[model samples]
Target: MDSTQELIAQGMKQSVPWVRTAGIEFTEISDGRVVATLPDVAEQRNHVGGPHAAVMFGLGETATGAVVLAAFSDVLDRAVPLVVSAEVRFTKLALGPLRAEAVLGRPAEEVLAELDAGTRPEFPVHVTISNAEGVTTGELTVRWTLRPNR
Candidate 1:
């Protein structure tokens, strides 16, 4: 129900060139949560006929980025957002047409307060990748930061 999906997707496509070629679709986005999916095409599949691990990682990254953008929509022009790190675990064999859900792990207002105080703030975004049937396949935690623009 979030209207910023289009703008975030466009910005992602331009900023992360791989997104354009990755075939990721932004399905839903909200204040601090987002859902994205990968098509069941050959390019996104692995040797076992499942979604490739890297593709799944991409989904996690993209979905987390969407939530970051949505949560910090009010401070866009004053900062530069970046993913500082990511730790992902592939727990199961993922199927095609996979979906990834990402949620911000910290409060937006808290992070904003730190940024407002001239301190670059970092937060975690947790992502869960699942199959069409709602079975989770992987979990990823991406640490993101909003750096104050000089």
Candidate 2:
């Protein structure tokens, strides 16, 4: 809805080939929260006829990335954000359209202060995956780092 959100979403859609191929849409983006959705078409289904695991992972990762970028966009010129690690668990068969919501694990102010002190900061973003019926089907946690561009 905001300019930054729009720019980030548009830029990612164009720059990330896999994002385009998978039809991921960033619906909400703010300082510490982000939400993304994946269409539940045949192309997104897996062998079980539900949403594929990889696609769900992609949505989780992308949602987290957007929240991080929104909170740290000011420091991006000096540091490049990267995913250090990720862990995901599929709880149920993800049928129908899927939604992923992500939030920062730590306070944005604390993380930004570390960056201001010229130290690389690592933070976790936790995401919950749910189907159109509002039932949770997966959980994902991603550890992201802002490595200073030397």
Best by lDDT: 2
Name the Cα RMSD for model 2. Answer: 1.0
Number of the top TM-score candidate: 2
Clashes of each: 0, 0
Clashing pairs in 2: none
Q: Per-residue lDDT tens digits of candidate 2, residues 1-150? A: 988889988877876778888888999988999989999989778999998898999989988988888888888899999999999999998999999999999998998889889899999999999999999999999999999989
TM-score to native of every candidate shown? 0.93, 0.96
Q: Clashing pairs in model 1? A: none
Cα shift from native, residue 51, model 1 (Å) = 1.6
Quality of model 2 by C-alpha lDDT: 0.91
